[model samples]
Target: MEREFRICSECGKIMFEGYVIEGGWRYYCSDTCLEKNYTRDEFNEMYGDGDTETYYTEW
Candidate 1:
């Protein structure tokens, strides 16, 4: 097993792989963090603010 530590783009929380949200090529710890990191207009540009869903994909 491997442990990867990443800083949340919004709140700066320490997170592992399975606990995160993705938007605009960035990783956040939660949907609230994603929302905080981006504005309505900015998020709207990313195909609308998703239903606070966690996006899972490789970086």
Candidate 2:
């Protein structure tokens, strides 16, 4: 299978393919941009199985 790639919206750097839990495609060159867009606490509140512990990994 061929993974799609794109440029990061914040830095304009090359981004690799990855699965998005909320659905749809996403392109982020680094964790910085990802975190900037979807914060850890916010993401856990939405996609997480009510487990806030995993949110700590964002840092």
Instruction: Summarize candidate 1's per-residue lDDT along 1-59 as a digit string, tens digits.
Output: 66666777767777664234333346766657767776646655554355544443333
lDDT of 1 at 15: 66
**Alpha-carbon local distance difference test for all models:** 0.56, 0.52
Model 1: which ten-residue window has the lowest total lDDT? 17-26
Backbone atom clashes (below 3 Å) for every candidate:
0, 0
TM-score of every model? 0.46, 0.44
Candidate closest to the true structure, highest lDDT: 1
CA deviation > 4 Å runs, candidate 2: 1-3, 18-26, 49-59
Measured on C-alpha atoms, candidate 1 has an lDDT of: 0.56
Worst 10 residues of 2 by lDDT: 50-59
